[model samples]
Target: MASETIPITVEFTGGLEMLFADQRKHSLSVPAKDERGQAVTVGWLVHYLCVEVMKDPRKEMFVLDGHVRPGILVLINDADWELEGEASYALQARDNILFVSTLHGG
Candidate 1:
């Protein structure tokens, strides 16, 4: 049986707002299954960039690279996952995910 299309909100940090918006409009394909053993659309995992940052313990080292970028906060709803459990948190239908950058300058 086919699954219903679930709507989800995705927010990006820093200058990624435009990129995230574009991503939502023409989302990439992803294989997801719903509650009833049916296939569903859950959009693409556009936050891989953040995941890469999390992988390294020496944050300063990774930060030096251009891929890391600024604004290092990604939240599921109002809760920042880094404080919660990072990407291990499972996404549900109609979830509002927000990503924001942390600012620090001298």
Candidate 2:
């Protein structure tokens, strides 16, 4: 196993920038082995993101849109895919994904 850097862009809802300011743009390296000597890959990172998003209570707001339940946008490398397609998107060694909130603010 080898180590490589993966670039990611995390988009936030309007006025929610402060929440993710520290992690707006990051270049994380997937180590060859974890503490238990397990290999890490981009797929693992994507799964982690999905889990994390759902863990936050605010995530409901994105889906509900204050009234209706329209799907939210999770762009991967500038492509919007709210279904399984989003996860299937191949992640390059250096790719960027902008997780934008689809709802508009007044």
Candidate 3:
């Protein structure tokens, strides 16, 4: 069952990478379905990042109200996530998902 999971690339930038072990890139394998037997989507990835991957306790800085916080942009395979169905996008094998924060702090 573990071998059946899909492998994908995840990247963070614009200071967001600082929260993820200070690494800008990550490789992950996720199950095909959720606990409810539903196909995994970008939304699932968000939750997984917080619960499983996040080393920081400031989850709200990554996700707010169950979704990606505003001012952050998500891209899939170099295309905007909104064009790919946003949170509903079904993750594919070897897909590249990037999270870039637009907020700048001095």
Clash count, candidate 3:
0
lDDT minimum window of 10 residues, candidate 1: 22-31
Off by over 4 Å in 2: 1-5, 13-18, 21-24, 30-47, 50-70, 82-84
Colliding residue pairs in candidate 2 = none
lDDT tens per residue, model 2, 22-105:
345545443344345454333455445544544444545433433213544566666665443544454555556555544556
Q: Which sections of candidate 3 miss by over 4 Å?
A: 1-3
- Of candidate 2, the 10-residue stretch with the lowest lDDT total is 62-71
Off by over 4 Å in 1: 1-5, 21-31, 34-44, 47-70, 103-106
What is the C-alpha lDDT profile of model 3 across 48-95, one tens digit per residue?
A: 998999999988899999889999899999999999999999999999
Can you list the residue pairs that collide in candidate 3? Answer: none
- Computed on alpha carbons, the lDDT of every model, listed in order, comes to 0.46, 0.47, 0.91
By lDDT, who's the top model here?
Answer: 3
Q: What's model 3's overall lDDT?
A: 0.91
Clashes of each: 1, 0, 0
